[model samples]
Target: MNRKTLVLPAAAVLLAPLLAACGGAEDGRAIVVGTTDQFIANEDAPAPLDPAFAYDTGTWNILRQTVQTLLHVPRGGGEPVPEAAQSCGFSDKASESYRCKLRSGLTFADGTPVTAEDVKYSIERVLKIKSDNGTAALLAGVDTVEAKGTDEVVFHLKSPDATFPYKLSTPVAGILSKDKYPADKLRDGFDVDGSGPYTMKVEREGEKAARFVFTRNPNYKGDIAPRNEKVELRAFADAGAMGKALESDDIDMMARSLSQKQIRELTETPKERIRVTEVPGLEIRYLGFNTKAPSVKEKAVRQAMAAVVDRGALVNGVYGPTAEPLYSLIPSSITGHATPFYDAYGDSDTARAAKILKDAGVSTPVKVTLNYTTDHYGAETAQEFEALKKQLVASGLFDATTRGAEWSTFRPAQKRGDYAVYGLGWFPDYPDPDNYIAPFLDSDNFLNTPYVNKVVRDQLIPRSRRQADRTAASPVYAQIQKIVAEDVPVLPLWQGKQYVAARDDLTGVEYALNTSSDLLLWELGRGTA
Candidate 1:
């Protein structure tokens, strides 16, 4: 929809400027925001705000603003800083023991004291529950979490992990009140007892309940100060609807759901009306193979398929300039990113791929099933997979069939090995090189792929995590990337740039799009027109 066609009445438009002049807090209106259906769907909704069970970005988006972590990665990104804790540090040079002192007089939204015991309980609960899709995997290094005293918490690790501090900064490690959450099971319902910048204002139900409201938390003890008294998160069916809402000023900002077409249009035509914030790329889209599938069980076949697919064509044709061809699981902006796929497969080499298949005693026109989620990865996903099918069929070495399901069904089916090959996307929990390497390669990885290399899982990853300076550990990650490329468990497709579109009058849009690819709602504020 065009700017002139926006549904907002002229009276409201005129009043908005006057309201901004009077200040955002005086009106007692929530700053409305919108995202795509995939975010608010029954399978993907950020409900049951229990930090221990909350793993998806939708959940983390709200938790990051409403629930405080011991440490937090700053907006532009860098070293972690104290959030709930007054200060935290490694107790020994080996980096095996870590300790943090809780800030004095910390309290949840309900006014219960937040102490070191709550921090310990929050971490212990995650490990104890260990949900299949939960972020507990990120804390695998920790052997135990102990409350040394009323204000002090200590962590004992199974081995040295230099990235442990960064892990604490993630939503998975968000400190929850022991009194609010039970020790044995995930907390029920949408009620949140968080101590971050904002707290839940209203928990609505039924067909009409499409928005979640949050008001400023009076008990927040962190560095973040809420710029608006209230914030509202609204869900939309698709990018077109979200764009229309943005144009009509129905929402103050749109996060993580705008399509490439919408993004490009808003960026070019009405640049003055909306401010678009692009954070450094950290998201990776890749093709995963289920090794148990007979058609792709052979390493040579997998390598040949990788060789036939052109990443350059996929990125430029399907994603436009919104993404870049990624050769490794790690995005190029991050340190230790290696283009091993380029070194091994080069550009689509149909002849070489055919030869490899023939050499492996595999016949021409090998049957393969390619699976993708239509709603999970945005509107371009179907087109992207179609492009892949076209390229693979053009090679004349294999017959590829494409199928799709909505995210809720797609995720579980993929994990259950329902597809021979599938598409997946990853937004890192932390920016460290280990976060990219270890998650996909470890023996018990999130991918559930049969491929596993001991050198990577047992040696390279451990060696890299032990290094105090991540730069010193770069070569190890490079080595791991090369191994991953060679194994072809998953083919790296492209890395995406983060975008947040807000009204021109909204302040702190850039700060809200943090380097971790998380939208920090607390950073947003209204500005005078």
Candidate 2:
């Protein structure tokens, strides 16, 4: 099993100013934001809003900012603060159960009371739809979710889950209205009814690249302290177009998916016009290999494949200084970040890669389909894939084909492991390194790679989960990354240094520590001072 260190929360303010350059919202002005996505998928429908099921950071960020949770990871980087639940802590350590007493007078957008029954239903829904959504795996070892009344809900776990409340802090844990929901269908694209600072004004369906919109809920009196009354999510298909729109004041801000060259130009532009915040990012991009594939069952072949990736080149040519080459699945900013793969197989050596394949009795060239996403990540994604293809071909051990889909199409395909080898980037749903390891390494997870380390699956992850406090779980996650370095089921590519460009006049933007993708809208307000 892996050994991770205790989780030490840090201040998220360091890189939050990146979104401040758009020069708007100084005094109660509405914040009009521009994002890489062209559409906003229904945050509440049958889709995965639960943190355990939802892996995309951007989605989680938007959802969390808009919804009410029982508990929350605190802002400005400290300990977790309570929300829907007024009082929460380990109710019983022996059984690994967590208990919480809900806050009074908290109601949904419709002025309906958020009761314990709704909380129970939300927890049950994660496990019930786990097969396709898979986020329920976050609670796999949990036993039952029992609520005492409208004011108290207790999580009874099969094992210890110290970070359980953080799980509750996710969109997945957003309490659903017992009236609108039924027991049968928990499909994606269902209209969401959440208790948060904002409500869906105009949210598009499957075509999230089409139209996604939200505004502050007049009834919302939750943790999210939104600065503006209305926030518009303007979608641009291309980063180039998005940047131009920002320059022309057509959009107030641009997110991290902009091209590297574009970021440079934006950053180098007069600071008075733009602002940049380089939060030591922890978005870890990786190449997932389906170990279940008959051909990929060979460990030697996997090792050879890991060897040929030139991570340094990827950062220099594709991402520039705003990014860093990653050898470990966990980034350095996180507590247990380690470069296990780099320790084992650092650089491309075609001769060695070829020998490893040959020693495994593989004389025929291996064929693997590589997948990429064009819309979700950034413009350089295609270039990164082409670089990978050339590097692998140069190794002479394999021939590869590259394919890509828009974010809407690529995500489902990536989760299903439909492609032989696909590139996926994880912006953590929460801060801890365990969040990174557990989601990807868990045997029952979406990748379904069939790459099991009994020690990890059965021991370490459980060990980390049961610890009630953050400090207790660290050692387990650290060891998990170390062991992962040796197995290399997925190759770590680069850690995205999060950058947001905003008008210099905008203020109060908050960021999460490392890869924990929490954007506290409450902390953002006009600069009245």
Candidate 3:
């Protein structure tokens, strides 16, 4: 699944003026990458930079570059390959026990030896700390992590999990330096000391800021090689400004933040200087119902809302061709994707939705509030929400009111169950079908809803994950999707297509856009001109 690209020599560090003069590096000069503010992470700030506490995409981008995991998905998009681990496999046929052997002579950035103890400590710390909004769900099946010796670590699972190896490849399973981080609590700082592909250097105009610099990690023992000696991630205020910077040669690449209009415009007008790569992404945008809320507590009310949602119109009207309608929680590219919602509801029929509500003994025109964040999802989100409101109100089964919040406020409030129904987007933590089903449906989910379906959390997901062959688990996933469609705790709105727009001279752009939709910053470099 991973692709390898031709790598060039590290570029010599250039002065500020010369760096901004060209999109590609002059022979042996650094390449500066420009991105929207969304991609930048503040390591110095308290925005959850620690592996145990971090879950956001910006932090994941930084972590993927600066931290090494036991295994990792290749840049070209394939199965998990050994990174820090020299080798890894299930010790038992039931997949109840898994083990890994660390590469010899591995050391942290500070020269401390990385042993199996460090691996055990990292996993234990995550389980012990247990951040409310973090990625603990990824390791739900893990019973214990024990260090057998200096090089060997064993994972004892409560049940068989075929996809356990893929989980270790995520940032959630990033190995940490036992000497640098505390064992009891989460670590906080501007400095990074992990063994990964790159080492970060933070520069701030203020005490706490997002912008920073990354250089190739000399101590890194992984397979990936840095194409540029230094990579500068410059953050702009918005997508429009980021696009302008790319057009004007202020930045070499625009990473994952541009709107549909901007992408189409770049495709049509620029024809020569810029190149865009659109790949099918695993990210899902959905509407989550807070089951605790009075307005959405009834199963019938939730079903009616789901029945009236026009996913086709939402994609074509707001997101354009950059995204497609998603009827199942698992996206189309994944093996278990089945159109249960589409089959059950059938293209936003208002009369059917009205009849469903009336038959449930509910009154006409149920009033409910919809919550969404403007800054987090994208600039196009406001339009998407407005379109959703129109779709619901037009059905005449409900009186929908839409509200907006900035992401900083929105995330905590949504988790607190403040909204009757809310819009949330998910970028996959791993590529497995279990990832789509487990995290959202489990009782102890990130959504913080009062939904506890034993059929899904206890039975279906466990059965599905235990199957080594994902194709064998497809029917179970289809059943899970059908249950989701019936309950309507969340409505699958759309799945996005990944796009990375860079100057034509940039090589390794394909390598950067991996299957997980995470950018491999190290693979991107200037082409010979």
Better of 2 and 3 by lDDT: 3
| Cα-lDDT of candidate 1 | 0.79
Error of 1 at 324 (Å): 0.9
Q: Model 2 off-target regions past 4 Å?
A: 1-29, 38-54, 187-190, 203-206, 209-211, 467-475, 510-515, 527-529
lDDT of each: 0.79, 0.68, 0.79
lDDT of 1 by residue, 4-54 (tens): 221335676555435544445556667877766443334433344577766
Model 2 C-alpha lDDT per residue in residues 1-529, reported as the tens digit of each score: 1111123234433434343332235455556667675444443223544343565656665666566788777654545678777888876746477888877888898999888888888778767766554566666766888989668888887776666766777677777775755544553552456888777654554535343456678877555455566566666678888778777776656664667887676566644456655544568788888777665668777778888878888788888887888888778887767677777786776676777788889765787778898777888889999989888877777787799987767767666657668888887757777777877788667566667888999899878766656666777777887778767788888887766666554455324223454555444434421
- Prediction 3 global C-alpha lDDT: 0.79
The TM-score values for the models, in the order shown, are 0.92, 0.88, 0.92
What TM-score would candidate 1 get against the native?
0.92
**Stretches of candidate 1 exceeding 4 Å from the true structure:** 1-24, 37-49, 201-209
lDDT of 3 at 278: 64
Q: How many clashing residue pairs appear in each of the predictions shown? A: 0, 43, 7
Winner of 2 and 3 under TM-score:
3
